[model samples]
Structure formats: C-alpha cells, structure tokens
Target chain A: MSALLEVRDLTVRLRVGGSDREVITGTTLEIAEGEAMGLVGESGSGKSMTAKAIARLLPAGAGVEGSVHFAGTDVLALSGADLRRHRAKVAVVFQDPRAHINPVRRIEDFMTESLRTLEDVPRAQARTRAADALEEVGIDDPARRLRQFPHELSGGMLQRVMIATALLSRPLLLLADECTTALDVTTQAEVMAILDDLRRDRGLSMLFITHDLELAGAVCDRTSVMYAGQVVETSAADRLHADPLHPYSAALVQARPDVTSTAERLVAIPGRPVSAFEAPSGCRFAPRCPHALDSCRSTEQVLTGLDAGRVRCERAATLRGRLLDPTESPTESEETADA
Target chain B: MLRFLLRRGAMLVATLLVASFAVYGALDLAPGSPIAALTGGRTPSPEVLAELNARYHLDDPFLVRYWNWLTAAVTGDLGQSIPLRENVSTLIGQRIGVTASLVALTSLIIVVGGVGLGLLGALRKGPVDTGVVLVSTVSAAMPSFAAAVVLQFLFGVRLGWLPVLGTGTGFADSLKHLVLPALALAATSVALVTRVTRTAVREELDKEHVQTAVSRGLPWSSVVRRHVLRNAAIPITTVVGLTVASLIALSAVVETAFGLNGLGAYLVQAALNKDFAVVQGISLVLVVAFVVTNLLVDLAYALLDPRVALGSRAS
Candidate 1:
C-alpha cells in the first residue's frame, strides 16, 4: 500500500529565547493508508514537534527544512487557504484536554467551530453534526453536553469531546500527541479504545505519539522509536517491543517495569536524555549506550535497512539477539562466543 | 442569581453606611469649628450665640448630631453650604451632570483606545508591540494634572483647537469643552487598561486551546475572536473596572486644572473652604458612584464568564 503520509529528512529549528535551536533533526517516517503508526519516544524526543510540523502549526519565525507530504500534497510549501485545508485534513489531539480547550466556550461551539467557519455550514446543521459526533464518542445526553462549557466536564469527558471535535473535519490523519498521558489509567484505556475503533471505522491513518512504548505497541501496527529527535528504529510494533534493533530502543524496553516478569529493579538508562540541539555530532545515543565502541563516538550513524526494519546503530547485526539479555555485557558475550 | 443580588445589595448598604459615617466623622473631627465659618470668624453676644446654637444644634452630642444629619440626609436634606449658602443637595444636583458627562466620555475613550491599542500590540507583536509598550509606559507614569496642563498648552493654547476653560453651554459644545479634561483624566487609566489587556491577550494566545483552535482550521480572525478575546475578557474587564472606578478620584485634579464647574471641582473648593455640608454631600454622591460602578463591573463579570455565574448557581 502506498503511504498516506511521508515525512522525509524533516529538520525543524525554532527560535526560542532569542536563539535558533534545532528541535527535530533529519527525522523520517511514513504511515500507510488506513494504517496506524506509533512514534514512541521520551519527552523532548521531537515526537510532538514532528506532529506539529505535519499540521503546519509551528510557532512563528520557525525555520523548517522538511518535505512533509500528506495525501501527495507538499505540506511545508502550503500557505493561506491550502495550509488551512491541510490542517483540517490532519487533526491533532493534545495531551491535556482542559488546557487544549477554551474554558469560556461551550463544547458545542468548540466542536462546531470548524464546520461553521470553514465549511460555512449553518449553525443548526453544524450543531446537529456536533451532537452526532459527540454521541459517536460515547457521550450520553449529547445535546446537553453540547451546551455545557469545558469546565463542566471531567477530564476524560473533555478528552472524548476533543476526539469528537477532531473527527468533525473528516480528517485523513489523526495525530494523537500524548493524548492519553494526562488521563487516569481506566480513562486512558477507554479513550484509546474509542480512538482505535473510530480510526478503524473511518479507515483513518494515525500517527500515535507517546512515551509509552508498550501502549503504542498494543495500539499501532507499525512503531518507530525516536531518540534525540532522530528516528533510530522502525519495524512491526510487537517486533520492536520483543527484539528492538537500536541499543536505545532496547534500553527503553528494558527500563519499563514489567508486570509479567519478577524483575527486582527497573533498568534505567544511565545519563539524562539530551535534546536534539544538544546532541553530539556522532551517534546521539553513544554517550549512554552500554555497547558503544570507540568508533561509535566519532563516526556518523545513519538508518540502515535490516530484516524487514531499519536501525541507526552500526553494530545491529553483531548485537541482534543479545540486546534483550540483561545479564551478559557485550564484551562478556563476545568472549564467551569466542571460547 | 437573585440570592447573589440580595447578598450584594446588603453589602452595598453596609458599605455606604460606613463610608457616610467616615465622611461625616472625619469633618467633625477637624480642628476648625463650623460655627466659626458660619459666623465669619467673629465672636457673637451670649444671646446671639445661644440662638445660633439652638438653630444649628451645636450643643448636641456627637451621636445625636450624626443621627440628626443622617436622618435628614436620607430625606434629601443635606443641610446648607456655609460658604455658598446654598442647599447642598441642590448644588450637587446641578453640578452632577457635568461630572457625569466627563466621566462617561473618559470611560469611552479608555475602553476604546486601551483595548484597541492592546489588541494591536498583542496580535502584531514585534515593532508594534515595542511601540505600544513604550508609549503606554510613559503615559502611565504621567500625572493627570501634568497631562492636563500639557494638553491645555498643546490643544487649547498653541493649536487653538479646543476650549480649555469652563463647561460649555450645549451638548455638542460641552463635549468639545470636556474633551481635553477627559483625555487628561483618562490618560493614566488608558495606559493601565492597555497594559492589562495586552498582557491578558498575549497570555491567552499562548494557551493550548488557542493552538487547538488554529489546528482546527478555523480562520485566524475567528480563533482570535472566539477563543483569545473571550478568554482574555475576564482580566481586561477587571483592569478596566478598577481604572474606571479610580477615574472619579483622579477627575478632581483634572476638573480643577481645566476650571470645569463640575462636582469634582466643587468638592475641591468646598474642602479648601471647610464647607463641611457640601463636602459631605459630594463625598456621599461620589461614594455612591464608585460603589455603583463596581457593582456594574461585578455584573459584567457574570456575563463575560459563565464559570462565575454557573459556579454561583451551583452553590
């Protein structure tokens, strides 16, 4: 299947506090039509930045060297009405529903705004559609909810409202930017189920951005793990979870506390995660990688294709099966193999 | 809503009563005697003094005199001004129109100029924002009396465009006469409202909802109006209310500078001459105006933000 959204060599530089800092550096990913792709990373890993770039919602004075193609249209080059249309076609759901909704406006107004203003739909008709959308998201008494302000609703309900509003534009791609991170676990599962069902029902493509690697693996068909603003690995979601190619991805998987296993301590990757602008010229993950060779500090790393996936690490073949084993260090494994 | 109104009304009455007592008691506590002002600083014969004391209740205790004055005040009798020898209420009634008109004009200018420039600064941001910040800062720092004199020199004397002295005869001429004074009165408040509005709007624009609004593909203008301005209205309204309420106090200087025969000017003259009755009456009226203006601003809050209104209802 042809990719519905393709982002190639996307680099974004933002002017923050009077200086230009690169936030996203040469990140590449693709989502096929009607397929859900997960972009998993820790905070400051450029997951949100990539979504904002696709939506054309970067802050003013931002410099973007990118080619974001959605439905075969170059998103970066679009301006005026075309940019607006692109925004409508690609919907984004942010993490905090309360902060992402206007407190003073009624939910009806928030949901119907795009229809009323952009499509020039009449008020009553737009309101009816909003009610219907609200109903689809499992909100009971949709008519009353339509009249209520955002503060009147709980966070989970407001998130559902946000999801309903996102669906109002009949968008081709839904960018879920840590949408469930702020909710309670139960609410998060419910919202995730709603989103998954709706995406399937509408044949919609989704770029689910989150810090939860397991949750992304559960929801998305394909997953891409990002570190320091670069996509380090892309493969089947379960495969990436089971046999991650990059050392950083392996560390992330191991760091997560597993309920099924009796691990005594959660394995933490040493050192703090660096932002894209602060990353070194060589492998961005080399500083913290346990298997880093001397060459890993000096040589440039690029995404190399292997076994139905891509990984940026130079020693992917040598370290393939040994990544998941926590007991054996790289040197010990090499010595044992030689013996 | 009715409960809220009733509670607010009771508070208003209590506040006014306390304010009136403070005004009445402060003048009573002053060193100079009302009798001295009444008698033109001359000593009267014993019989004459006794008669004057009987007429004015000068020998009554402080509480007795306050009760008598308060009772008569509630009945529209504010005693007679010693200097002007006129009924205090009648004098105030005549002068209230001019001050009211001046205040209304100044408020209009404040709302329009302040909100407009603020919105311009926030939305335009770079050079325009800098210019607004610079201008508003200078204006805010300037005293209204100094502004009054400068405005008088520029518009009234140098340009010979507007009349600087006295309240003019008719509506149109009166508006013309009041323009300079009103501008001077509004100068500091306009700057205040502008700074508040600009800050509120800029903050609202940065909110995530505003970003969501943009991402929804709504027109930029629509997003600003529906999301940014609506959310910013609370703070803007609060600052506007505070500044406008303060205009009453600041108007006294502007009125005296421009020589407008308004209540503010009358109050200043009455205070200087120790016309206690006139001062008391005007102070009561000014207090009422301030309280009523604040009450209106509170009502505006209920209208602008449903959270306040609905929260009250829910309680």
Candidate 2:
C-alpha cells in the first residue's frame, strides 16, 4: 500500500517560558492508505506532538524541522487557505471529550460548525448531516442528542459525539490522541469497536496514539514505540507485542500484567522517562536498558532495519529471543559467547 | 427556571427589608436628631416641643418608629424631608432620570470599550497586550473622584469641550452635559472590565475546546467568536454587571465633582443637611437597584451558560 502520510525526521522545539525545549527529536513514521498505525509511548514521549505537527496545530513560537508530506503536499509549508484545507482532511479526536467540546454549545453546533463554516453548507442540511453522523456512532435519538449540550451527556456519549464530529468532513486521516484513555474500561472497548468499524468501512487511515500496548495491538495494523521523542521500534502490531526488538519496547511489553499466568510482580522499566531535551548523550535508553553493554553508552542509536521491522538498539541481533522472558537474567556466559 | 426566579425574588424582598431597617436604624443612631435639624438647634417653648414631638412621633419607641417609616416607605410616601421641606419621593423622582441616563451612557461605554480593547489585547499579545495591561492598571488604580478631577480639568476646563455642570434639558444636551461626569464615573469600571475580559478571554483561549475548534478547520475568526468569546462571556458579563451596579453608588462622587443635579448629588446634599427622610429614601432606592441588578445578572448567567441553568434545575 502506498503511504498516505509520511513524517520524516520531524524535530519540534517549543519555546517554554524563556528557553527552547526540544519535544520531538528526529521522529520518523508513516501511515499507508487505509492503514491504522498506533503510536505508543509514556506521558511526555512526544506522540501527541507528532500528531500535532502533522495537523499543523503546534503552539505559537514553536520551531519545527523536517518534512510532513500528506498526499504529495508539504504539510509544514502550507499556509492560509491551504493550511485550513489540509486540516479539514486530517481530523483529530482528543482524550477528554468534555474538555475538547464547548460546554455551552449544543451538539449540533459543535458537529456542524466545520461543515457550515468551511464548506458553506446550509444550516438545515448541516443539522440533517449531524443527526446522521450521530446515528452512525450508535447514538439513539439523534435528533434529541444533537440539541443537547455537552454537559448534558455522559463522558462516553460525549466521546462518541466527538468521534462523529471528526468524521463529518470525510477526513483522509484520523488522529486519535488518547481518545479512549479518559473513558471507563467497558466504554473504552465500545468506543474502540466503533472507531475500528468506522475506519474499516470508510477506508480511513489513522494515527492512534495511546499508552496501552495491548489496546494498540488490538486495533492497529502496525505499531511504533516512542522513547524520549524518538521512534524506538516500528513493526507489525502483534509481532511487536510477541517479540519487541527495541529494549524500551521489550520493557513496555513486559510491564503488562498477564492474566493467563500469575507473576510475583509486573516488570517495570528502571528509572523515570525523560523528555527529548533532557535525554542524555548517545543512546537515550542506555541508562535504563537491562542489556546495555559498555559500547551502548557511547554509541548513538539510529533506527536501522532488522528483519522486516526497524529498531534503534545496537544489540537487537544478539538479544532478539532473550529479551522476552522475564525469568532468565542476562548471564556473563551468554555475553561472552556473543562476544 | 421559574422557581429559581421566584426564590430569588423572595430573597430580594427579604434583603431589601433588612437593608431598609439597617439604613433607618443607623441614621437614627447618629448623634443629632431630626427634631434638632427641624428646630435649627434653638430652645423651644414647652408647648412647641410637645407639639413637634406629637407631630413627628419622636416619643415612640425605636421599633414603632421603624415600623411607621417602613409602612410609609412601602406606600411610596417617604415622609417629609425636614430640611428641604419637600416630599422625599418627589425629590427622588425628579433627580432619578438624570442618574439613570448617566448610568446608561456609562454602561454603554464600559461594555463597548472594555470588551473591544480586552479582545484586542488578548488576541494580539506583545506590545498591544502590554499597553492594555499598563493603561488598565493605571486607570483601575485611580479612583473615580480622582478621575473626575483630571477629566473635568482636561476636557471641561482646559479643552473647553463638553459641558462641566448641570444636567441639560433635552436628550442631546443631556448626553453632552453628562459626558464628562460619565467618563469620570466609568473610568475605573471600564478599566476593571477590560482587565477582567482580557484575563477571561486569554484563559478561555487556552481551554481544550478552543483548540478543538481551531483544529476543525473553521476560520480563525469563527473559532474566536463562537468558542473563545462565547465561553468567556459569562465572566465578562459578571464583571460588567457588578461594575454597572456599583456605578449607582460611585456616581455620588462624580456627580458632586461635576455639579450635576442627579440623584447622587441630591443624596450628598441631603446627607449633609441631615435630611433623614431623603437619605433613607435614596438609600432604599440604591438597595433596590443593587438587588435588581444582581437578579438581572443571575438571569444573564443562565442565558450565557447552559451548565448554570442545568445545575440550577438539578438543585
């Protein structure tokens, strides 16, 4: 499949207070036509920044480097009407629906505003379209729902409303930025199911950002694990879950508690996560990697092709099968044998 | 909504009653008596004193006297002004129009200039924002009386533009006459509203819904108008309402400074002459204005914010 969106070496520096902080550093990823790509990371890992950069929604005074090409157009270079047109093609559904919807405005206004303002659709036609969109999201009584304000709906209903609103413009790509993270578990599953069904039926490409690895694996075709603002690994979603190549990716998979078999404790990656600007020199994950060698600390890791996937670790070849099992500690004999 | 309004109306009546009692009691507790002011502090003959006491019910207990004043006030008879020798209600009626007109003009200036400048400052940061902040801070710091002196000197005395004293007879003339005093009265309030709106709009701009609106590919202007300003309206309305209400009280200083024959100026003159009936009558009117203004503000809050209406319904 051809790539619908290509973001290469995109580095973003935000001017915070007086100093400039690099939020995303040399991040590269792509979404193929009709593909769902999951971006997995901890908080402050720049997943949301990447999505914002693609949509041209970065805060003022932010400095961006590298290219974001959407359907042969340079997204970063777009301005005025062209920029707005680009945004219309890329819809975003944020985490907290309550926070992202105007509390005072009715659902119809929130949903139909883009159609009415951007496309100049008539109010009556827009309202009809909004009701249809609400129905598509499994909301009953669409007519009544459209007239209700955000505060009148529950969080899950509001999220569905937001999803329905995102789909109104027939966007080519959907940016779901932790869209289900704010919902209850059951509601999360329902919203996820609705999102999956919509994406499949509409052939819409998506960049789904989430912290939950299993959730990403369930809905995404491919997954990219981000660490300190860089893509640490990109591979088939199930394969990433089964055998994660990057040390950080492997650590994340192992951090999940298994329901099939009981473990004494869930494995957690050592040390706190660092932002791109605060990351140390050389390998950003070297300080926390359990399999790090002396050379790992000195060599800066770049995303290099290994097998059918990409990984940033220098030791991916030797440590492939050994990283998954939590019981087996890295032994000196294995290291000597590899050497 | 109807129930909420009815409850508020009842509360308003209760508040007015308490306020009237306080005003009457405080005035009564003052060192001098209405009898002294009526008599010009001269020793009266025994029969004359008896007749004066009998006529004004000066020999009645405090509660009985308060009840008498309250009953008369409720019926629109605010008793006779001892010093002015005029009906208190008639005096208030003649001056009320001037004060209302000044207040209306001042409110217009405040809403337009304040919201406009505030939106400008918030949307265009850097130098314009800094300038707005600086100017508003200075103006807010300056009291209305001080603003009155400066404005009167500059526009009235120095510039020889706009009238400085006496409310004019007709609409155009009255507006022209009241301009300086209104500016003086509205200066601090306008500054206050400007700062409040600026802060509120800036805060609303940072909210997630505004970001969502911008991201939806709606025009930037539409995003600001429909999302940011609409969301900011509640707080802006609240500040504007409070400033407008307080203008009734603060107008006294401006009226005195400009020599306008408004209710505020009449109030000052009455208080100075120890005209108890006039003072009480004006105080009651001021209290009623305050209560009714607050009621309107609450209703405005319901109109501006659906959440408030919903919450009130739930309660």
Candidate 3:
C-alpha cells in the first residue's frame, strides 16, 4: 500500500531565550495505509513531539519546518477551514487520559461535542456513532458511561474512553502517544489488544509512540528507534531484536530481561542520554558506541537502507555480521537455534 | 444534592444564631439601655422604670433577652426602634430595596466587567493585560469613600449626568441615583474579581483538556467557550462570594457619601445613635445576607461543576 502519512525532514525548534533550541532534528518517517508503526525511545527523545508535529498541534510560537503530507495534501500548508477539516481526519490519544479529559464535563459531552459541532453530525446521530465507537473499544454500557465524569472512571477505563472518543470522528490516522504507559501491566496488555483488533478491523493507520521496546516489538508491524531527536534505525519489529545495526538499538534490545536468557546481569550502556542541545557534531551515538571509529566522530551519519530496513551508523555495512544480535545472552546455546 | 443543600441550610442557621448573639451582646454592653433612649435622657420614675423593664424583659440576662428577641424577630417582630418608634424590621424592610438595588447593580458590573476584562487580558496578553492590572491595582488601593468622592465630583458635579443626592423616587430614578455609589462600591471589587478571573483563565488555558479539545478539531471559539469559561467559573465565583462582606462595608460609606437613604445609611445612623434594636436587627440581617450569598455561591458549584455539587451524593 502507498504511504498514508509521510513526514519528511521534519524539524521542530522552540525559542527558549533570544535563540532557538532544537527539540526535534530533521527526522524522516512514514506509515503505510492500514499499518501500525511504533516510534520508540527513552524519555525526552522527541517521540511524542514528533506525533504532535505530524498533527500540527504544536503550541503557538513553536518554529516548525518540514513537509507533512497526509493523503496527498500538505498538512502544514492547510489553513483556515481547510486546517480544521484536516485536523478532523487525524485523532490523537495522549498519555494520562484523565488529564486530557475535562473534569467538569461528562464523558458524553466530551465524546460527542466534536462530532456534533465540528463534523456537523446531528446530536442523535453523533450519540449513536459515539456509542458504537465506545463498544468497538470494548467498553460495555457506553450510554451509562457517557453520563459519568472523568474523575468517576479508572485510569484504564479512561484510556479506553479516550481511544473511543478518537475513533468516533472516523479519523484516517490515530496517534497513540504513550497511551498505555500510564496503565498497569494487565490493563496495558488489554488496551494494546483492543487497539490491535480495532486497527485491523477499521484499516486505520496508526503511529504508536512508546518507550517499551518489548511492547513495541509485540504489537507494531514496524519499529523506529529515536534518540536525541533523530531516527537511528527502522526495521521489522521482530527483526530489530535479532539483528540491530545501530549500536544504540542493540544496547536497548539487550537491556530488556529475556525469559529465555540464563544470564543474571544485563549489559549496561555507559554515559547519560544527551539532550538536543548537548548533541555532538557527528554520528549522534559515537560518544557511547563501543565500535566507534575516528571517522564516526568526523563524518555526519545518514540513513542508508540495507535488507528490509534502514540504519544510520557510519559502519553499518562492515559491522553487520559482528552485530548479529546482542539481545541473546552470552551464555545462551546458539547451537539450539535455527539461523 | 438535597442533602448537600440541607446541610448548608443548617450551617446557615447556626451562623445567623452566632451572629445574633454577637450583635445582641454589643448592644447590651453599650452604656445606655434601650429604655434610656426611649426616655430622651431623662430619669423615669421607679415604678415606671420597673414596669418598662418587666414588660420589655430588659431585666433578664443577655441570653434570655437574646432568645426573646430572636423568637420575636422570627415572628416578624424585630422590636420597636427606640429613636424612630417604628418596627425595626419595618424600617429596614422599607430601605432594603434601596441597598439591595445598589448592591445588585454593583455586583453585576463587578462580575461582568471584571470577568470580561480578565478574559481579555488573559487571552490577548499585552497592553490589554497591563491596562487591566494597572486599573485593578489603582482602584483596589483606593478607598471606597475616596472613590465615591472622586466619582461624585467627576460624574455628578462636572458631568451632571446623574443626581447628586437622595435615593430617587421610582425604580429608574433610584437606579440612576445608585449608579455613582454602585460604581464606587464596585471599583475595589472590580479590581479583585478581574485579577482572580484572569489568573483562573490563564491557568485553565494551560490545562491538558484545552489542548485535547483543539486536537478534537473544535474551533478556537468552541474550545474557549466549552472549556476555558466553565473551568474558570469556580475560582471567579469564590472571589465574588468572599467579597460580599467587603461590598457591604463599602455600601455604608458609599451611601453616606452619595446622600442616599438606603439601609447602609440606616445602619450607620442606628450604630451612632445606639438605637439598640435597629442596630442589632440590621446587623443580624447583614450577617444572614452574607451567609446566604455565600451559600448560593457554593450551590452554584453544582451547576458549574458537577464533581463538587455531586460530591456528597456520589461518594
């Protein structure tokens, strides 16, 4: 399928003092029609910012430069009523649903208001569609739930309601930015399952921004790793774990405790995560990578496609065989596995 | 909701009872008795004085006298004014409209003008904000009597737009006469309410729900109307409610300055003459008005935000 949303060379800068500070570098990514792509990173990696930028929802005065093409139209170029119509087709579910839902308003008003007023759907018709959307997200007795306020619902339930509210507008793209991060393990699993089923059923494209690599590996069709405002690697979710070309992606996959690994201690990546302001001149990860060469520090890194995915490391081609999979514990039986 | 209202009603009764005791105590502790005021400063005969004391229950303890007064007051008999020789309640009843009208008009301006300016400052946030803050600070710092004098000089004398004296005869006339005093009374409140509303709206603007509403494709107008206004109402109502007592105090000074025959003037005259019955009666009414105004403000939470109003029932 053709790309449903294409974000090319997107950069976001916020004016902090007299000067502009880079929040997101020139990051490029895409989501195909009916595809679920995961943008994974540690805190302050600009994953959520990327999701917001895609929807053109940045706060006023934020300097945004890039091309965001959705269904053959430039999202950044749309203005007036066109922008309003464009926003309706793109829905976002943020972390902490309770925080995003107005406490003074009932769930029904919060859910149906956009549909009735913005979408120009009739009240009764909006209510009907809202109920159906709620049911699609696995919420039972939606009519009763609608009358309750945000404080009345639990965190997990509120998250489901948020998802349901997003789907009510029949958005072409759904942006879930750390949506399940605030939920518990069981509730997180439940929410993820619901999202998977709903996306497949509706053929809706989704960008799931998360920090949990394992979670992304489980639910996403493809995963893109972000670090200090740059996408370092993009590959099939399962393939990323078994063969990560970027050293940062390799360290991340190895950090997760595997149920199958017999090793007791996990390998820790040295040094702290850098902010955009603290970024180095070349190969963003060179300072921390164990395989860094002098060239890695002198030359800028560019994403080069190899096999089924892309990598940004300067030595990705030469180091491919050696970087087989760090996720495998040192003591695990390599002979027992099929190559 | 019914239970919440009932509980608030009971609290109001308790508040009024305590206020009545304090008012009655101050009068009882004062130098002369109501009978002394009745006698025009002359000593009465022993038999006449004893008969007066017995009939009026002036010889009873303070609490007993308070109970008698309260019981009679509740029955629409607030006792006869010593100086006026008219029913205390009746005197106040006649003048309540004047003061109520003044207060109502003043509060309307304070709420609408203050909140409107506040929203403008918070939404626009440049010269409009600076102007609002400067005005609020200046007016808030200015005393009500001083404000009254300046308003009288500028609007009443120079402009000759409104009457400079007595609470006018009819509704329109009275309202016209009340304009100066109301504006004077509203100045400080306008200052207070505007600051409160501006802060509230500014805070609400930063709330996540506001951003969420915009992302939902709601227009700027819809997002502000649906989210910002209602959320800011809570803090604004609180500021307005708490200002009632100060507003009452301002009315007394403003009424005297404007030479309006309102209940505020009645209160000031009664206090100075030590007309114990009128003083105590008006004091009790003022206390009750303050309490009831607050109760109504509290009840408004039920409509503005269901979370608070439904708090007791939901739990």
**Best-matching candidate per lDDT:** 2
Colliding pairs, model 3: none
Docking model 1 quality class? medium
- When sorted by DockQ, best at the front, the candidate numbers are 2, 1, 3
TM-score, chain B, model 2, is 0.96
Interface root-mean-square deviation, candidate 2? 0.6
Error of 2 at B266 (Å): 0.5
Against the true structure, what is each candidate's TM-score? 0.95, 0.94, 0.94
Q: Can you write out model 2's per-residue Cα lDDT over B1-315, one digit (the tens) per residue?
A: 778878887889999999999999999998888878888989889999899888878899999999999999999999988776789999999999989998999999999989998999999999999999988888788898898889878988899898888888788998899898888888888898999889999999999999898888878999989999998999999999999999999888888888889888888898878898899999999999988998899889888998886235532
Looking at candidate 3 chain B, the ten consecutive residues that score lowest on lDDT are B306-315
Which stretches of candidate 3 lie above 4 Å from their native place? A325-339, B44-55, B309-315
> Share of real contacts kept by model 1?
0.81
RMSD of 3: 3.8
lDDT of 1 by residue, B127-219 (tens): 999999999999999899999999999999999999999999998999999999999998998898899889999999999999998998878
Ranking 1 against 3 by DockQ, winner: 1
Model 2 TM-score relative to the real fold: 0.94
**Model 3 over residues B23-142: C-alpha lDDT tens digits?**
888778888777877787899999999998897777888788788899998887899886777899899999888888888899899989899989988999789899989988998898
